[model samples]
Target chain A: MAIRWIALRIIQEIIRDRRTMAFFLLVPIVVMTLIYYALLEDEKAKLGVVTRGVARFYEYPLVSVIEEDEDIEIVSLDIPDKETDPAELDRLIMEEMKKGKAHGILYMDQQLLSERFAGERGAIHIYLEGSRPTSTAAIFSSIAEAMDDLTETMPVVIDAECSAKCANSVNIKAIEIKKHYLYGSEDYRLIDYFLPVFPTFFVFFFTFIISTITFQRERVRGTLERLLIAPVSFSQIILGYISGFIIFSSVQALIIIGYILALIQISFTPHQLFALGVTLFLIMIVALTMGLLASFMAMNEFQAIQFIPLVILPQIFLSDMIWRIESFPLVFQWISYGLPLTHANIISRKVMLQNQSLWENWPQLLSLGGFFLFFMLVMSLVALKRNKNN
Target chain B: MLKIEGLTKRFGKLTAIDNLNLNIPEGLKFGLLGPNGSGKTTLLRMITGLIEPTHGKITLFGKWTPTSRMIRRRVGYMPQQTAVYPGLTVSENIRFFGRIYGLSGRPLEDRLNDILELVELGDKKKEVLSNLSGGMVRRVLLATALIHNPPLLILDEPTAGVDPVLRLKFWDWVDLLVKQGVSIIITTHHISEAERSDQVVFLREGKIIQQGKPFDIMKRFQANNLEAAFVRSTNLK
Candidate 1:
């Protein structure tokens, strides 16, 4: 009955509260739809390519080029020693590369223009720096195809003619490669990657929404005093609250998971579902801890609301929703590991997408559980001490 | 019954309740009257276990130190302000505090009906606290404090902003609670209400300047009203 009454109050409190409605129910779905459309649905990757003699070939009808005003940030490094310069100019170019001012550099040797080189054995030497690997690969493939077209017009040399044991090496052969998938096809889009994170994201959003606003309201409304005086021990109250939110957050998790699986057809392994369950549970605990901390710090609801960007934005970014930890610097990986959501992401991806077992993830599961328990203990103590002192 | 000995509370350099002591047996309506900063609320808060007195012993019903939950269940506290949830309806607010005291079902419903009638807020039970008038909210706060039928009731300022008609009715309700063996501790500036108290303790600067039956104290000060007597006592100090 106590749980039911409190749950009813929690429901009523959220339903009547406009900010609560906005943050929990509306924001997650809005952001998810927007992110899905902004990143995956009909979105094109923008590349800045710097070309030397490969421009005409790149403009061919078979190539897909997405042109913006700032497309192809071309930088010309016209020098004999462009790749290995010892001059101040080379230092400046290296600085630009380090500062992300240049994506790729291509140097075309003037020897290609000579009529002597236009006959049987002449070729254009392409010196391309392959950093900014994606752009480099794109440019290299396009230029290499164009160069292959140039090579078609010239007579081929047989350098291995004296090697009698390899006489069939001169015989031309064409190989065709075909690819197939057993589960997710090659067309398994970017949302497949984002699908795993949506559960974590939604859980985080709802937990944060429910805990922060409710706890802040308790503090501001002065009913916290009433609770302090009640027969319910502070720890019990905290425990009850944590349990209540966990119940609600689990529902939220199931809802989002169902949506992704049923409406969106995102494949998730049972282990991944288990990992997601653990993640949602951990997120609820983190939310309770954050809410208690926010309750202690914020003087009003507006101040508590300010914690959303300060708290949630970093979790979203560092939890590998859009970026991977290995792709980040070493220092960032350590920082991401320190975040609860990072563990959630690891466990969820491993279990859901990779089909890993729970026992194998005991280390992460224990760490997240330990963090929640430690926080619960600390928060309960703080709440007790604060109520005793206030 | 509540008992205090050598009760002392200090906020940094300033001592709020300085080595104080008081005792109120069951069924006694005790008044803790004091000027601003005289530690009236501070003392009530300590008794309710909201704040701990640094140097004193507090015994609730002969227990040396009462746990918060135990004292909270039996002792009703109405803070100086209307501490009810402004968003909740009056009956809902009462029901919340009632459930905190472990009251529910038919008993809780009956108690809710009784308290609303006691506070003369039967019609406003469905009204949100924020939507109610200040007087109505104050009455509802008193109703909340009394919802559990606690043996000890402390009203920080139960009659503030209340019209004289309701103020008289409020005291009459206190009298009824007293008749039912419930102890009452009230703080107020209304001398006429203080006159009706079973006992009054005048405090100044965290010290009890005078304490006795209200008419006796008035007679001792040669004043016709409790207000003049309070002024005389403070002036003498």
Candidate 2:
């Protein structure tokens, strides 16, 4: 009940606070929309299709049909005097691929379609830049889908025996891949990545910033002195603060979760909800420790403001939210290891993606639980030593 | 309800509060007086369990050493500095402090309104703390300190930036609090104001140079006021 009071206060602050509300609501939505539309823009990707004497091929009904057509630009390059300069054409396409001007390069041989091969399917070689995995995959998918219908009409030669698996007799070896998603496979956007971590992150970040300043304010305001002469104990005061912030952070999480679910189409598995709760619990404890530590380090509000960039930025970067942990060097890896966010991020992603139970992630759960206990102990000790006036 | 025995606090080799012995028997309005750097603040902080004394124990309500939560619930503190959250509204600041003290619902709302009216900022509750003048901020700070209605109130320079008229009004509230059995220990350099206390402890360079009722100390030191007694005790001519 005491904790509930503090949480309500936090909610009141958020509702009455215009600036904080803007940051929490408008900023993420604006950024997510920007990324979505930007990625959806057809002009972002360039494809160079080079075919020998195949200008007529573009008029085909199959070629007219394209995947996310507006999002991709298809540039057809005629193999200008292909017999006279075939190597030059390949060299030019490779250059375009290297410079990222073209995502993939396609080549078609006119001779393969002549004489005895007139009724047979001609080989059309496709070369992807391979520099960017996403663009390369997109180009491959577009061409594969187009050829699916065309291959059935064209008579193709077979050289090897047919088998249930690894059949090599067909002229065009078309492979189909079956994809199954655990969490979100249909819409793998930037916002989806944030959905798993932001609930806990905001709770941790806001709680730490608010609570740190609060304790210092108590000392500066003379409330600490008044409390000392009363019948109350120091532990009760600390608990009062802890309960207050826990309530504040919880309300924040609830609001964020409620908003995302109501306004956005993101869905979560039932098993993942426990991970979210536990992640929030661990993050709040981290906030509890950080708030206590910040109070000791700062004597004034100005000093506390400067602590934000130092405190917030590192946690965002090193937490493995934006990039893979393996991308960082060994030395920096050690620093990420020290951050509580790293573990929380990892655990959140695992639970959300795999729908794992609490018992399955006991190791991470134990580590986070240990961090909570350890940080709480450290904060209590720091609280014990702090002078009410300072 | 508060007892201090041989309280000593040191910052490295510099002793801030030296073997200070004091007692505030239940419901006494005590005043701590001192010059700058006289450890008046230090002594009060040690008693409140904000800072642990190096060589002594403070017993509150019969407990040998008070825990933070117990100490926090029983006392309301207003420090010397301007401590209100500048980013928050005047009402929000009071409400936050009230909530931390476990006050909520209709009771919390009533006390919040009452304290705001007491501070003469009932009309300015919507105003942000940053926009308020220094004097108004100090009043809000006091309002927050008194919100919990703790049995004990510790105020360090509660009237420092306050105007003379407002300062008198603040004392009126303090006196009312004492009448209701709220024991308060306050530290101030304003000697004239210290005269109103039931008991006064004068400190200089981390030591209590004189201790007595305001009238007795004034007469014993042969000084016109508590300020003069403090100056005379420090041999300041």
Best by TM-score: 1
For model 1 chain A, where is the 10-residue window of minimal lDDT? Answer: A173-182
Local distance difference test values of all predictions, in order: 0.68, 0.70
Clashing pairs in 1: A272-A351, A272-A352
Writing each residue's lDDT as its tens digit, candidate 2 over A110-141 gives 54444213334445566665433345557667
User: What is the CAPRI rating of model 1's predicted complex?
Assistant: acceptable
Interface RMSD of each: 2.1, 5.4
Task: Provide C-alpha RMSD values for all models, in order.
Answer: 13.0, 14.3
Candidates, DockQ: 0.40, 0.22
